[model samples]
Target: MIEAYQKLWPNRASVKNIRTQQELEQQILIELNDELTHPRVRKSKEEKLALAFSRIEQSDLTKQQKKDLVSLYKKIAAQ
Candidate 1:
């Protein structure tokens, strides 16, 4: 998780220099709050999935195609 944060916010000094478990937890909480409250941060996986499903619903794809796509998504998620 630290590695992911480092990759996402390489400029964040706290993320780059975590030295203890407590500090890591604190940094994670701070970053998580930032992610939740900041509009410009990337959306969570569930949000992105919901957006994709919504787009699929709005698209002009055939019903069977949509069903197939959803089934494929479900299968992938199951793994």
Candidate 2:
């Protein structure tokens, strides 16, 4: 991967232009979609929710509080 990127950016000694923010974001979304939908990544809704909940919990929130916040955010996002 690194070699491929370096090949694509031979002139970029810093490689700063190897991936723009928009490109990186699009790639991230693509990876997230794949991870979210892949059975190997998440076998069930519970597994998906657990992965999300874990991320929320890591963000300075208690387990129950994270769940509540995630629910609230989902509601707001849906609207």
Candidate 3:
């Protein structure tokens, strides 16, 4: 979604300039892959958990499933 893309790349000109959903997705994927693969750009555990939670919120899973998954993630993070 446009909102997700904007949240991920708030300062990216491409996010604002995208003319199609496909283009926006492509740009987002490229940036996400770069961030993920770049060793120096490692995200902290809490940041990763937050991103995961955001994704779970956006997914098509049932509310109960999302709740369970979030609880599981929190338990894992606490360890």
Q: After aligning candidate 3 to the native by TM-score, how far in Å is the CA of 57 from where it should be? A: 0.4
Candidate 1: which pairs clash?
none
Clashes of each: 0, 0, 0
Give the candidate number with the greatest lDDT: 3
lDDT of 3 by residue, 1-79 (tens): 4554455446767678777766754664444345545678776667777886888788766677677656755755675
Ranking of all candidate structures by their TM-score, best first: 3, 1, 2
Give the per-residue lDDT digits (tens) of candidate 1, residues 1-79: 3343344446766678976656655664443334546577766545544654665577666676666655544443344
TM of each candidate vs. truth: 0.44, 0.30, 0.52
Report lDDT (Cα) of residue 41, candidate 1.
Answer: 71
Using lDDT as the yardstick, the better of models 1 and 3 is 3
Per-residue lDDT of candidate 2, residues 30-68 (tens digit): 333445365675444344445544566665545565556
Candidate 3 residue 43 Cα shift, in angstroms, is: 0.2
Q: Once superposed on the true structure, which residue ranges of model 2 sit more than 4 Å away at CA? A: 1-36, 39-42, 60-69, 72-79
Local accuracy by lDDT, each model: 0.54, 0.45, 0.63
